[model samples]
Target: MNPPIDDRKEYSNNFLSTNSPIYERFSQHTPRCHRGFDLRVWLNNEKNLTRTTCFCPPSFYGDMCQYQNQRISLTIQFRVLSDSWSTLFAIIVSLIDHSKQRIIHSYEQFTYL
Candidate 1:
């Protein structure tokens, strides 16, 4: 015979419970400032694999930490300031072969405000 199930109790236990303070303190709470930028990069190849993230402080250029993998091709994503007076930016992705210290396949895009 099958055992009886407590539907109400089970439903309550399954629900997720949390407080704002827990999330606020531990998580990135503030909206990113216009001058601040973030970068995420990954490297994958037959020789080696790696992943890196960089946070650029205000008015910085390129990857903040210059994360690189010598044996793999890397993929980079980032935003940067524009040449216009308005608040503009750019986003780019490129495959970098750190073994040779050069870019293999790359796509760059720019936007104006």
Candidate 2:
């Protein structure tokens, strides 16, 4: 026999839980809070259609907030030093901007003797 469904667990990507703060204050039904908008509307309002629009906050974008937005700039510098026994290896330097709307990702290696 098949197992019975569980009502406690919710599986909606678009709508928040019924107990969510936004839903409790602004909406009587589950609400959507992602992507480029936060949407809330009565599920039983088919007979009386209503329209609303909500925009996403900073660092958020896309139709369902499925992607992260960022801007990046990189700078690299190199230097070498000499030692009595042997020559010091080259050193690498990296500079990056980490603004609110920007992300920095990088990888590097350095060696010295």
How many clashing pairs per prediction, in order? 0, 2
Best by TM-score: 2
Error of 1 at 15 (Å): 54
Model 2, 1-113: lDDT tens digits are 63444533433534687677987887665455555666655556668765555576677665556567765555655454544647656656444556885544554557766
lDDT of 2 at 8: 30
Q: Report clash pairs, candidate 2.
A: 35-64, 35-65
What's the C-alpha lDDT at position 53 in model 2? 55
In candidate 2, residue 63 scores what lDDT?
Answer: 59
Give all candidates' CA lDDT scores. Answer: 0.53, 0.59
Per-residue error for 60 in candidate 2, Å, reads 1.4
Query: What would the per-residue lDDT of candidate 1 be over residues 7-82, giving only the tens digit for each residue?
Result: 7677766564455566556675553323344443457677577655556553444444333333435565555456
Tell me each candidate's TM-score: 0.21, 0.27
